[model samples]
Target chain A: MSLDYLTALIAAVLFAAAPLILAALGETISERAGVINLSLDGTVLFAAMVAFAAARATDNPWLGLAAGGLAGAGIAAVLGVFGLLLGASELAVGFVLTLFCRELAYFMGHGQARQPGPDLGALNLPFLSDLPLFGPAIFRQSPVVLLSLVAVGLVWFFLMRTRAGLVVRAVGEAPAAAVARGLAVTRTQFLCCLAGGALGGLAGGLYSLSVKPGWGHPQGCEGAGWIALAIVIFGGWKPVRVALGALFFAAIQVAGIALQDVLPGLSGTLFQIAPFPVMILTLLVVNLRRSAAFREAARRVPLLGRLVPRTAGGAPGAIVGALDKGF
Target chain B: MTGRTSSLARAGFSLALALCVTLAIVAAAGAPPLTTLAVMLDGGLGSGQAVLRTLSALVPLLLCGAALCVTFAANLWNIGVEGQITLGAVCCVWFLRDLGLAGLVPPFLAVPGALAASMVGGAAWALLSGVLRTHGRVHEIFSGLGLNFVAMGVSLWLILGPWKRPGMASMSGTEPLPAALWLPALGGRPMSLWGLILAVAAFVLVAWVLNRTFFGLTLSAVRQNAMAAERLGLRPKRRMLAAMALGGALAGLAGGVLVAGLYHRLIPSISGNYGYTAIMAVLLASGSLRFLPLACLFFAVLTVGSIQLPLALSLDSSLAGVVQGVLVLTLFAARRLWPAGNTGSTGGTRNRGSAA
Candidate 1:
């Protein structure tokens, strides 16, 4: 394809990847703080439905976005209460909430399905829009894409450069130690989960108001949440890598669409279904480096041995520690 | 608060809380709460036909719940049960179509053969995730969720591509199987008695295996501490794999029943969220096999009754889902509030002794 076509494809990838990046980043935060929110898939769907309906009703996308974020925070609060305070299994609670929210969204948003709603249109930056290859691809996008970009940097900075970030990391790494150090583990985790939920909510709003631009039962965003969860793992619970994982997933989706013409039989169905398996495979590979058998097998092949890392580690200490706790 | 009395009290409180929450939602939706409840009850069990419909729905729920309980007992999250069910149905259909065995073999043989194929298909699908967990180090939840999507894609491809009906491919699904391949209906009802019978048998077998056998003790031991179980000569991985396979087989059998008994054909939505709903049923049972049938029946009533919401109150059928969700959440809340006599073990707690 021509450079212009390629740029447009890249732009499409960015637009699509924005939601995943946002949701995954949110999950990264929650999980980093030792709270797992499996309700993301349902939360996104519910937020999407709510945002779309609110926007259509009020004729204001901003209000709709706020509503979506609030809904997300609300759901996260429930998770926090049960998981952090009550000491329930966050995974189980989140899973049930996911199903519940999904069903509720369908039930409540039935009337709003296929209805017209405001969409955030493209906002091209003057100087940047005129730049060579990156102009149209990066600068001439909706505010949501820009927001997602800002979020990546902000999240990275917040986690790496701030005292609060240190505490969050410490809490996730070792809740008992954090507690001993006078940090309120439960309160910090609860707040982190809520913040993550808000981001996830915003992601849902972006999905409806920008990316897909409509509400439909079993909307196009169904499995996107699970992919976000996997992306968080794929990114190794880091912000920058998480963003990359989201972009990579989006690229796969765009490439799948692009390949529809060249590979007629396999492109549509197979391509659409490709991300899940590919994510699972990526997870397996990322994790396999830690396995002794894999290391032994790698040792037999000189090239593989050279390529393999000496150690596969970097899971948050608290997460690894909590694994023994059965969560 | 001790023993059975406290447990009963907790359950009662959770049910009441769930009811209040659901009623509040109904009110918010502009429907009269009492009227809606009455309508749902009538729709689910007012007549013989309604009860039959509820019972038919119960067959799959019970089977899936029983299946889930096995995996849960072993501390394995078989979230891919939905996908397994779909694959099972797909395999059953494939066996009937490609092998031409439906016509070649006797009715009795063909029916059992198709079901066996379904079980194999489901088990194999689940085993993929099991291997991933044991060897690949990937969590079962993520792998299972991913596999669920892949299974859906496969079913869609079969329906819209290879197995597309004559003329035009549609979402209506493939043509019905031959009469000889179909399971016989119960007492002139649309559903098959065989499905119900099979589900009950499976439940009884699982309950016995889980509660009364040495295998049950070992399985629990493995769940409680895989490392310790390994030290004690039990292969944790093998037990886990067996548990997953058995769960898959049960769920697959549910799917087989759906095809051979109810739908009479393999459709994309054949699984119909039964696998997911079973999770709620199993959770509601809270480690007690005796409550499994009751939980399944309760959910079946809500599901079958939800059909009336659209017809009577102009509400979506998904209202049932809202109720189910509220119920589970409240149940969890109640368990937390009254931990004294709660016998229902959250999956995380039974194995690792974590606070969760």
Candidate 2:
């Protein structure tokens, strides 16, 4: 491919990766706070429909985005009320919410299906838009992509450098310890759920208002939520790495479509399912890396030691311990 | 007896709440709520044929629900049941075509042979997920879901590539099996009594094994505390694997019925979301066998009835899913307020505990 073609492909991949980056990071926030938002798949679809309907009715894309964010937060609030407050399992509540929200979206958004609606326009930054390949790929794109980029930086700084981030981590690692330190564990968890859900809603809004740019039955982004959830584990709950995982998945998607053109005989359905097995294999590798045998082998070899980090990151302690204590 | 009455009353109240919420949703969507409900009821059970359709739908639901009961008894999620069903149908179709068509198998043995192949196919698929959870350290939920997608891909490939129809390949699925290969139905009707018999038998077998057999008690013990069960000299992993195998076999049988008894061909969506719906039905029953059949019947009616919604009300057929999901959510919420005074509720609580 020519350099121009390569640049455009790269730009397209980044653009497609924007929503997934937002959703994965949103989930990253929730999981880091010791809550697994399993309703993510349904949340994105519902938010997309709500965003499309609101934007179409009001003729304002930003309002649609806000509505979508509210829709997501509202679902998260239900999860919290049932999970933390009422003593139900968060996983079960989230699972039910997944199916509930999905059907609700389809039932309520039927009329809005395939109807044209307002969408966010591209942002062509002045000097940056005129620069090299970076300009066209990063500067001259949808504002949602910029939001996702900013979100990565903001989430990283918030989780790593801020005092509130420390409290969140402390609560995630040990709710009892955080309680002893006078931090309200439930409140922190509830707030984090809301914040994470809002981000997830924004990601959904970005789809309806920008990326896919319409509401429909399939909506073209049906399983994106599950992909985002998987990306969180692949990123090991780190914001930057999560964003990278999203970008990588988007590339695979684009490559799948591109491969169809080269291999004309193969059915397109084969390519559509390429990411799932890859996802399973990636998860397998990640788990294997943390096994004792792998660490011992790394210790014996100097080169392997550099490749395998001394400390293997794990899930938040609160999640495992909470499971241990039973619902 | 009073506790049973109160539990029944609570169920009635939750059902009423679910109905109100569904009707309110319909009103909000600008449709006449009562009319829609009546139309759905009429569509589902207005005629003898419609009831047959509902009963046919019930066959798969009952099988899958029984399948889940076994896995849930052993405290395994088995989310990959959907994939197991798909693999079963694929194997059934393959068996019918390769052996029956080629005359390698007698006409009398075609149906039974195909069903057996499907059970093996399903059991193997479920075992893959079980092995991943046991040895690879990957959670069953993720592995099961991943395998579901892969299974879907496999079915699609078979439909469009190797097993495509004679003239052209399409999403409609592969060539229909010969008449002799099809499962027998009463008086040439679409509904097969054999499928229903198989489903009921599976449920009865599960109930017996879970309630009376020594293996059943061991499964319950393993579920209560895998660590404690291990210390007691019982092999928890082996029991879990056994439960998954049994569950997969029943689910695979459901798929075989779908192909041989109902659709008469291998389709991309042969499983028809029965596996997921069965999961919901199992949850609604709260791990009790007595309520399992009732839950399956209710869901079956809604599914079979909702097919007519678009024609009658111009509404999407997903209304069925909306109502089913709402009812389950209401029950989940209700359990918080009205904890049943029976082991049924205790079983539900214990299942959630093991989910952690």
Error of 2 at B137 (Å): 1.5
Give the Cα error of residue B169 in candidate 2, in Å: 1.1
Docking class of 2: acceptable
Q: Can you write out model 1's per-residue Cα lDDT over A1-327, one digit (the tens) per residue?
A: 799998888888888899999999999999888788899999999999888888888999989988988998999999988887776777778888999999988888878888888987788899988887768777888878788989999999999899999999988877777888899888888999999999899899999999889998768888899999999988889999999999999999998888998888772767888999998998998778666777799889877787565545456665663433333
- The candidate scoring highest on TM-score is 1
Local error of candidate 2 at B20, Å?
1.4
Q: What DockQ does each prediction reach against the true complex? A: 0.54, 0.47
* B286: Cα error in model 1, Å: 1.4
lDDT of 1 by residue, B129-235 (tens): 99998878888888988998899999988898888899988788988887678788987688899999999999999999999998888889987888899999999
| Share of true Cα-Cα contacts across chains kept by each model | 0.57, 0.46
Q: In candidate 2, what are the lDDT values of residues B180-207, reduced to their tens digit? A: 8988996688999999999999999999
Off by over 4 Å in 1: A295-301, A305-313, A321-327, B100-102, B344-356
Q: Estimate each model's TM-score.
A: 0.96, 0.95
Clashing pairs in 2: none
